[model samples]
Target: MKVKAILIGAIGIILLFGILLTPKLKTVLKTTPSDEFIQLMYDGDVRELTQEQLKQYKDDINQELIKLKHRQSFEKIYLSLGKIASLEEGYEDSNNYLLNVISPGSHTNKMIDLKVYETLAVNYIAMGDIEKGYFYFNEANNVAYQLQDAELVASFYQLFSETLLNYTNHTNFPIYLLGEAVELTNDYYKKIQLRKQLASVYELNGFFDLALTEFIRALDMSVEKGYVDLEIKILGRLSLSYYSNQRYQDSIEVINRYFELSSDDPDLFYVSLWLHNHYYLYGYESVQEQLKSLEEATSNLSIEQKHQLSIFIDFNQVFFLHSDGQYEECERYIRKLEKLKTKTTISELTGLLIDKMKLDLDYDRGDQGIDYIKEYRKLLSDLQLTNDSVERKRLIIDNVLHHLLELGDYETVYQYTADLQKPVTQEITIINSIMNMIQNSSDSHYLAKNNITSMLLKLGSYVLSTLAGVGLTYGAYRYNSYFKMLKRKAKESTIFDPLTKTLTKEALYETLELEIELGQNELYYFLLIDVNDLSSYNESFGYLAGNKVLIEISNLLKIYFPNAYISRHYGQHFIVVIKKPNEEELLQLITSLINEISNNEKISAKRPITCCIGVSKGYLTNTLDIDEQIKLATKKLQISKQRGTGSCTL
Candidate 1:
């Protein structure tokens, strides 16, 4: 029996040694130098990969794929990096690979799903399949919502809106989508960004008044967030919007403010562009100084920044030079711009080509300008890009009209107006017909009376038949608007602590409940704060001063946890629930609150203030009532206060 037991023990030891050694042996044999793959990604040098290197990399990736244990997680990182590398490699099959990977049920990570969708949407957009692109963009947005990531949701919406703005069939979609984005995000910076995008969309749609409103909102939010860079950008956009709406004085004021804030930015290209455009509109001479400043600043920019800066500079310079009668210089700049055009993004290229066409027309180079216009049309057709090219088209038509008018070609001008797509020309025709009909009328009073009588007759019957319909329509519209307003108000209130215009106890409770429901699943302490000297302060300094101390404490809470929810439980007591507070953060917050209250000038004679905090940490069970838990914490707090003037008990 002893020999049999010895044999079993020896076999068990051998089996244990084999189990421990197997994985290490396999790892040593199979390991390859992943550094090259990692280096290519980190250095962004995939474009320089040799064909042999690419083949080796593909083979290695295939081998890695076979060996991957965590397929779902591994594929996410692989495909994301692969997509970037594929784009750099200029591979024709890259888009097909991306599309195949973005199929349903392929990715489980919400962030991965968002990236995949975005890649696919961009690819589709580049392919001129806007409808499919938008569908994928919307799918990505839904995933962002499911993930409950407000920042991601806002970003997707911005991209989706911009894409829609570039399409003629769905211009209005962007306006509404941006409005929704602004509503979803609570961060001041993101709100301003969405507002700016919305303002741009509104301006593109010819809703100047609405555009102004959104731009002003963006400016205010930028100021509130203390975002100096964004504030300057918004100011520039505001100035542009005002100029577009013909509010020249407002434009000047806004542009002057932009100059003030953006004086330090090395590349003031946008400012220079705005100045040149507005100068042409209002015939202002001050733009020369701005132009000089811009030229000085452009010397320090990096190549990429210079590339962007030069586009705007050239765009404005084309017209500025023409207006100054430097046609030769303008032609030189146009040629320089054409060389740089190939490196430009699609949007920049479109704007530049259109501007070139306009400059050619302005210089009486009509035949040459028509050639440029044909090129512009081909580019637009090829890219399927659309926007308010109405103004540019109108400028072209106006030049044609003026040229024909000067040559006594009235018949041709009339025919041209009939063929033009400009709303202004259509309005002019309508107004001329109305004027002619009035002039031909034999009795003006009789015509006026007939019009009034006819309008009244139609209005009476229309009102009688549609009064209920109008009321119902108005009721439905107001109801939806009101519902949205209430939802927004509720969200705003949730972030506010009602007692001191900070976070409230109810808000804290709701936040905790949400965290618990979301499976944070961690053990943390809840602190019950009781004001020990509040009664003394109330008696000596009056409740107003006492309230001031409370407000000071609340302000300190805000400083400690700008995103934390704080709540007042009673007249002199507050509560703070932290996920897990370290000794440093908790003690620092308490010390700051006490010091602020004790030293507050509004506290009358620098009244002494003190507080006690009780903390408890354990897995909270459903059996323990919240009020009972608070009472237990308060008892511990009272004991701490007895031990010292300002103390914490745990």
Candidate 2:
């Protein structure tokens, strides 16, 4: 019994020693900050880290950030880890480290600055804080501008514009910004990208003329650059834009062009297949042949590619099948997309949303279609995702309008028409009032002359009759002219820039105001801009060039605050009323605008451009009498300029 007890004690002591000294046991009990960090990074790289592991790693690094004397090394490791965290969608951890751990001054490194800003911008975008997202995007652009790297600058604009385009009100702004980017960069590939983005923006804003221009430009650029992938993508956009504009022949032509260009590449070929399917659904004569071709082409693709293609092809197939009265096939395709939706990543959701909507439409379930669209919108809203995808909302709106019109729901249509007619009605009232005043003054003068004639007694009747006849004729002519003017004004106000017909600033402003009024109050803010360099721009660029600059600035303002109210307040000055903007976001926006204007070779290459901005709390009142506010804002803006270039006040 004594021998057995001794053996047990020895075995137990050995086990205890192993627990104390083993590498795994030591790692668990006595892990150094560096060891844990390295391990965390490894786990992240290998995709084995849990949310708790990520949180702990972030905490450890943040603590190390305070104690580390060698900040240069610390920043590198910290940013490196943050990048990994960002990839894993640990946005909170990544943002905390980027925003809090690293010194702002340490962001002097261009690459690091780019990464940090991009990550932060994306995070803010993910959180549905577009104001902050744009702010960081502008920060990223500033860094790229500092580097004098045109490609990077173009890329930043592309990303920023894309984010802005996700919101309906901000769609036009991205197009304008992308145009600026196109002017700045000489690289064919970058130019193609800018054009593609511009096309998407224009399409979203219902600017078919501009959309077509951009799509053609992109196609040309892609051809020039020999980028088949880009060519295919642009072709797809072109087809959609054409389809939206009801240019069915042009849509078919572009889709065919895409099919030809992508014939050699399977991925591109699959895209072509999708385009062909859409073309068929849009009522092209050659759709049957195209469908046959699509099936044959898709058959040769790998299982994964086929599955991916089905995600798009199947959805489109549902539309075509439904149109052809093949309800069973449509249901099958709907089920396929429904199953695919379960496994889709957030990036794929937009496309999936589109597919689901088509399925709903094909099933003869208009209510279901509308419901799906609303759900899709909510998903986008929740994810804070923005891009060309949001343009789908316009289609949904059109669909709803069509359904209402079909059901002879005139009350609903009238309500929509009233909403559409409000701006026109306002303009007409103003113009008619001015015309009435002129007519009344003329009538009074004629009456005074007639009274003088009546004093003569004999010619009184003749004079009165002559005067009445002339007045009636003139009034009739004036009435007709006023109607014509109203029509002209309505068209101009909706489509043309008030200052320059190249674009419509008023339309842009009204759209912004509508967005603010329509959106959830807690989510938006405004930034009122007043330009300081219009005179300089006009003087240097010649009057035409000056007009171009005004157009360019208007376009830039549109891009920078797509979801915000942007308008030409007066001569060489503008106002942007944003939604739910914080102070830091306002500063970032001001800084970006300043940098963009100052760095733009088109505007600033020959002479520098400067702007002073004021940030207000929320959407400005339509009745608030903008004259005094603008003057005050302009005066404050001048003070900021006197202080230095690129200054702003709130």
Candidate 3:
């Protein structure tokens, strides 16, 4: 019922946005008058061109250039020549040729001159002369404004922005231009696309906060415009933005939302990626089964799409083969991928993964893996690597750590760990920090609560996915704190906690990961409840009284969320994972849970028992984004705690 309402609501939103965008969508869809033909003379389409079409265009433009040169030389001829030249990466040639149209002795066509400036800007940016590119872009904008050609200006802005992207991620200038373009054009479809570009630029620059805002706004506009295809595209890009940033959990969460909205045959390659994240987070043990299933499901993809999808498929093969003791097969696939890596424009994230696989599979040659560390780091410096590249790098470093530890090279290992890499050792350190902070219920501890919660959620994700090998490296931990954690883990090995009688933290995450891996097509609501002021209860009543409050809340949780998975997440924090078809039903349930906890006589002491609840919901996306959702809920709980006695937050 909740999912149905959401679908209906989503449909309504699309209809409303479409109605709002009718005028603007019409504008872009409508053909330009002869006056605008001058603009069309430059470039007819703003969309990505296929190789065949580009080849044909290059041929056609060259023929036109020859014809114009034979007859009478004209500004359009130079523009045509320049356009063809630029396509061949002949930036300098294109620049010199384009300058012919604007040269003192040549034609004085204002529109042609504006186009020349825009083209030159694109060329210069592609050539790495960003400052020069901006200068020409400004010139083009000025000419566009003088002509009062909003459509022309908009197209130019979009073109230059796309061009600049290849050159740099510092997108402030393009952002300014795109903002101007969006404001100038009433073309809602174009506006959404432009906003997506703007958001992407923000993301590439690591301004995820800004990127998220723009992405959400664009998503709303896409839905409002009734552009389901566009909405799907927006969601896909937004997920990539998150994935490229190493917010895999968030990436999975967005993908789940994508699943809820996307069609049956949504983008095949990203679907594969979504599956990959699903398995990585959830079904760590079911690689062969999942891989075989995905291969069958995606067999219908085009050869090109399959080529792209192979990265995920092949990587899993290497991983699964290694695990299954098919060492020769695993080594063969790894070698094949190493060759594949050279031929493909693999993203840094994928590159790191390939290298990390090498480290994992070739533990005997760990030092060789360390040698490649500089190259990966160079990728980081070049910004080709995603933010999560650091984590991937850490995994490689861990492999190196194992090799060095065997050689008894403690000094070198110490040197390597001294840097900012959050290797397995660092994860242990973080766990230590969180455990320590949990005991201290002071103001500062609560202040640290939000960060700790996020890290713990992340740690929970690593517990299965990437944590396997890291688990081995933990043998090097000589600290007593490490042993204490091991003892605690040993004692709390069951699926349910011994006290308060709910799913243990590890078990809750495991269940969430598995649910995501199963790719359940149901809306899920994650509610993170932090029992407020536990120390106060302990202080006022007694330790047993505090225990009774926790126990009673746990029981009430089962009664209230009968169909939900309830878990105790260590120290005053409890997690409730439930599926409700409609959002209203979830909200009502939250309200009831809050009231029940506050009113139950068994739970109440000097004052009614209170808890801060943070909630997040989406259809089960196979994203194993449960961790991200939990993180969000935890953040909301912290916000509630910070906001002072709030019943709940979303």
Candidate 4:
């Protein structure tokens, strides 16, 4: 699952960069979109999408726009169309795209609304309208941060950060988001890529020491994992990072290793950079000789590579000519470099050199512009440049389908995304309830048949306590220790949440079963409540903090629905069955519950709390299957969770 999540993240981010980040195409994809990917894109069954289809997505947008011109209504495909328009349309014309993104009838659908808010935010940031960007980004991020899946929320942070990379003055924001992304992923390669991305952002702003740390870490992991291809490029960037920090000797040594490992195909940009940096150490003549050879080296290069290389060569020549006391030639070369910037977009970091260049050939803000990231474009290429393997191709196809469709599939979105959850078993919950009754109650006769099991559990607890007393050392666990506390809870016929003291699944089922057996007709509203990313709460705070959240939710349940039957249904879910006086009263209760959850002193003081609830109401009868009703309510919960934007009821 960890590997799969990373794969999904990599594929989704890469595809997103192609479509949403760049807006304009950079390199033409070597591999075509898989037939499966294309079909999924058009069929709208896909929840993820591949970069290969981005060109198609772009072309289709224009085609769809042409088609929409004649049509009276076109809300079904509005999300995709609006996404591209929000980007392609400049900030001055943003209102039209905003209108297109948020059609009047589209406000009810939270998922679509989320995508709209996110796109508006990203587009505004890219356009340097930071005020509007901050507004929408906070709105969208709040919605996404409240999603139930930790992976999806992490994915969104990365997506937002990566989008900010191409253009935006939000420096620390990308670093923070990428750091969040790095911690969330488990895949070695993905971590390396994310770190490189984080390092690249640092490099962009002259944070060479910080960039070096990440680069070295990525290098170590790449070598340990035998990813020679990635290691070779990291060496080139490390050389530049060293030079940026005035470690000239170290830079030369790293550059030597870069060449040694690179063998026949050295990176052209770094090759030119090396010449300028090592002018004194390698001798003016030796550097001059290498510069002559550099022109012949590009004979076999592509047009785009040649364009980017030409800029790199001119950039270095500006500095070299300046050092040689050839001020006039240096000025001419600087002018030439400025013209080269408009030719192609492949330089990545070198594209910034001209912007920061001064009349004296020095860079502004103390940032050595020429020393910024060269590995960034290559890093993304190594990670997402190709989709060669059949399995990987399918992974890209499926993941991309869902990522794009995350705007909302109203019907199947929950089924696709929610399937990633690591659910708590009802058996374990029942056992917790069972042990609670045995431990808290006076009589042991009801469960005396399970004496041996009870004895073993007691012995295990004693052993764990003894070990803790002895101060046993262990690494931090990835998940919460909630399960470890389950044995301490109470109940038999009535199952209870171990921490919250609310009912559990078994107790709710038993209650409904008894009601049906007694032949009672009742009018009740069933609400399924779920907290978003509860494990994150555990990981961020402690297990105790997470328990507090569950307890607080239970408290809110009692406050809002005092007459209702409330249960902490398994994991982060809560179930509440109540007899409502009227629709208006139920709405008020739900609104208050959501408001309290968000602003509560106990739960939201440290981290803002958010939840999604699914409400189902009907007249219950002896003939009606309660399980079916529960299933319907659960399905509604899934819907609300998927269409997340604070606590929602469907």
Candidate 5:
């Protein structure tokens, strides 16, 4: 039913776009209602409802079909029934029936035929048959454009975009299709809607800064056109983008603007809850008053709206109570949230909150809290792949690590710390060092400050005496030091990049020269990786975050191909040369590395750090200059950027 709702929303826009391409359906040969009602089915014996209930539902649809007199009307009803059967009831055969009935040459409106083809594509994608799904999807798109109906084309593109984004493995194609939809529409609001939809897709892919830019563009249009509702929505999203990039002050300012614009709107309460959660630490009393006012204003909200608001409001209260050290009160609110878990999407957050509270309560009671530790560990294992590495998750995991240290559980602590360190920022190295220190200090007693000061003074005196003796012989050392300095500078100038520690361009060329002389027949593959949106990331999250990402990428490349010749070129691009015999193996390795870089959730917390890769393979020969190979790979990298931001061009 939600899928139906979404489909209606997307296609509903088609009519507004002025696409009147509805064709009539041909008459169905006399097939009585009792001949055969569509039997709904599911895979792996997973029935959504009992067989009897499904039969009755099909009977109702068939009865309605029987009442329709016109052939076109009957076909329309059949399409609706097919949609319900396939989407809501998991009827695979109903999809096939839909395709046959609304086949391209059939006597049906272009809109109905287009919908049927799109629906089939969506179903196939959902069922894990991407090749057939893409075939039908492309079929629907081609027909829409062929009809030369702007609205139909836009509609097909929009819904098809959603299907690909939500169900399939691909994202770039859908995003490109959405851009096409936006281009096809001249309507201001429709264009804005399409842009916002595109931004949501970007946001889901962890491209927050890109999403923010889109939101800002749409916000500008909303302001110019006096579209208050759309403006408020965009402001909300823009604020979240700011928050994710750690621009808290900007986030607060945007939230304040949103509050001013949406004071009397029905969505004000929900917006207030978002503000309360994010900005509560800034002004507890003010946020509390806002919550109270929103609660008193709840009578204006619908039942469903109230449920949604209550879930967040209560969750925020749990956070507030926990912050205030009201563990008992926090538990009460946590329990309240758990009860409403089935009614909300915040169930996972609630479970995390509960686990955190239990750990704190157990610690307060002076127990080891082993059960709480085990519970949190299990939850972390289950959620690690699915959840982003946000600050809250880090704090929770770090707190657990600190608890483990307190309990002298170094074995468990070591395992979690090691696992957490891989994707975390370089700052985690400090934590690792601290853990090592703690583990070493566990069997020792603390030295008194006075005793340590005395020992430090004795060691310092001895070091100073040795240094003074050495300083007496400085004349003899100066000439040798000057020669060493020259040698060090010469080596530094020739070999590694100062910033990234990879090979310099000159060094890479020199290596290429040597390889050509010795291994001319060897297959050398050149991989060029260009970080996408890195400049935007620097603008949004500061240059430090951008530098961290670059360093991380360089480190990852080193780890993956220790023997390869790697270089950090000017800007946010890295070049790696490897002598693998198989081109397919090289491409596969490059693809996996690109995916790893793109989906690194730790870096994604500040900004979605993504990169495009271009891989070119050839033999190391005297005639083929390294610069020419780099140029070829750079050309492919540029093409990859055009095709899609985070794609690979081979």
Candidate 6:
């Protein structure tokens, strides 16, 4: 699943870059629209709808525009219509409306016009008029460079590549373009797209090392952005990349981490994908046990979910039969696969899996499947080819399809640029709107005929009114933004320590209290962990180094006891509480953590940073206070510290 996610990212990068370089066919009305919002509309990020629903949506926009008294606002309505047309794949209508619209040529409009040119380029490329497409593409590129807009530049790199892939056999070219795009943008989401594309290109070309590098980069970005879905996808890809690179243990470890991250995944799709990856890594028997566990975990699924799970379960059964050398059973399961093929589009991943199953069947059949083996090997060779004509041709279409899929996934994450100004606010937006109107107006004679005093008076009043309106609007925006930030911070601070991100002491106690009240019949263990020589390390190597050690140790603890309640009180002191673990289990966990921490090469430390662990275990009840348990743990911690660094007392 993780591998698939990483590959998806790679494919996303390819698609984005493919269209970005394909042709700049997408044209929009010369109006104020953000690059992100423009991309969203172009990518059909708005909710998918039937033809009737789409017409109604367009009618709604038009009706809303009709109610507006301002003539200037009408241009915005046309732009909105153009965007909708684009979404509906009515490229000709979108182009005509965007190109024929009466628009102002102000700087803001120029930026929008750049997008229009790019849109037109894509439309043209899709229509098979590559010459016209490239012309518009160049025009858009020129405008983008002239404006010095990094975001637009980044977007172009992504979108142009996607467009190009539709019409040409450019398998590896999108990677370079996307890599440039990655360099141009600081936006986390954008970089994620670029890196994923580049990685996908590399992975498709059999450049596993390069693919892994980009996947890892994208994975880091996903983690930083707190995009759980993206993180899961990246991890799955990372694990698969590891597997492809022949790092089996690394692959297994990453798959385990995927499970840890998605323990409570609410989606059946996510669970099914994870299970698929698990089957590949752990084989049939282990996956059967996993499926049983999953069945229990997802027992309360909806009817729709049950249907999806059934499909996935059947798919897994095919693999299980094949792995078990039950050739007849596998042959029966092949019918299920054939039925599945009719239900969904045959994706590259699906094709690959099908081929593998066929190969397995052939291996079992000996000379009976010789021709099948030859054909299968040939197909695999084409897919893994570095330099082949068939591979090149396939990449052109594949890259574009991948880009479209990426856009859909991106919509799921970003939802059409939430930060874009509302249509109401955008219509009157700023001084630019007024300036564009004045500059483009045909009645310049009327303005010239007015007396200087009269014109000055009108201009002053208009400027003052616009400025006042802008100030109030900006003030409201800031206030709301700040309020949201405050709310987020307040919530975060209550549950987490500001620096370490571990649970706050209060939060830890609350968790313990809640668990105790649940009346569980089990022993709960509280452990106090103190970093040995951390202060000395801080003094010798700098505070940043000490913080690094703290963070690394905290992460290790989290990994070792993901379900446990953990907290940080003093700068380098941590409290950990877990339930009902045997002595051997506890020792192994601690020993593994200690070994990893001491040998940590990622941290730039001169010597090993060790820890003292003190533990206290007892039944949770009203008779025993949580604070008393901590005190006992702290006492044992003091003993461990006295004994030596890396010492533990229970």
* Per-model CA lDDT versus the true structure: 0.59, 0.58, 0.66, 0.60, 0.64, 0.64
Rank by TM-score (best first): 3, 6, 5, 2, 1, 4
lDDT of 1 by residue, 229-290 (tens): 99988888787677656677777787788888877752454566467566766563566567
How well does model 5 score by local distance difference test?
A: 0.64
- Reference-based lDDT, residue 82, model 2: 69
Please count the clashing residue pairs in each candidate, in the order shown. Answer: 5, 16, 8, 15, 3, 44
In angstroms, the error of model 5 at 269 is 6.7
Cα-based TM-score, every candidate: 0.43, 0.44, 0.47, 0.41, 0.44, 0.44
lDDT of 3 by residue, 11-121 (tens): 999999999999989965553222233444545462355556656665665665554423334566667567657766789999988888887767467877787898898
List runs of model 5 lying over 4 Å from the truth. Answer: 1-64, 67-77, 84-96, 102-112, 126-132, 165-170, 268-312, 321-329, 339-650
Point out where model 3 deviates above 4 Å: 1-73, 241-268, 280-283, 286-288, 296-311, 317-332, 339-650
**How many Å off is the CA of 406 in candidate 6?**
33
Better of 2 and 5 by lDDT: 5
Regions more than 4 Å wrong, model 2:
1-69, 101-118, 137-152, 166-169, 266-317, 324-650
Any idea how many clashes model 6 has?
Answer: 44
lDDT of 1: 0.59
lDDT ranking, high to low: 3, 6, 5, 4, 1, 2
lDDT, candidate 2, 1-650, per-residue tens = 99999999999999999987898776455644645554443232323557786667667766766766654656555665665577576778878777753465653467667756866876777556756766676566555544655555555556556655453234433544476578666677767877787777656545568778878977887888789888888887787777767676677677778768776653544455455545555554455566668678669879888877666666567666677766776677777667655676635545545554553454364332144334433443433343444455555545554444333343443444334333223223322332333334434443343322123234434333432443233221112223334445557666555554433455655564565476544443444565665776577656656666677787877777776656665567666655566668767877888889878887666677777776445334552423445555666676777777677776
Please report the candidate that would top TM-score against the real structure: 3
Candidate 5's clash total is: 3
lDDT of 5 by residue, 1-650 (tens): 99999999988887755454443211344444322332221111213456676567567767867676666555555665666666563658768568667656568766666666777877887666766676677566545533556655666667667765555324434555576677777678878878887886666445677788888888899999999888888888777677756777777788889888887763544365465545544666666787788689776879888877777687677667666676787778777766654655654644666656656665655354256556556655644433332322544555655564444444565555344322222112322332333334433333122222223233434433432343222211112222334345447656877557788888888888987787667777888999888899999987767877887889889987888999988879899998864677767777778788877865676756788888777776774567777888998888898888778887
Consecutive 10-residue window with the lowest summed lDDT within model 5: 38-47
lDDT of 3 at 272: 61
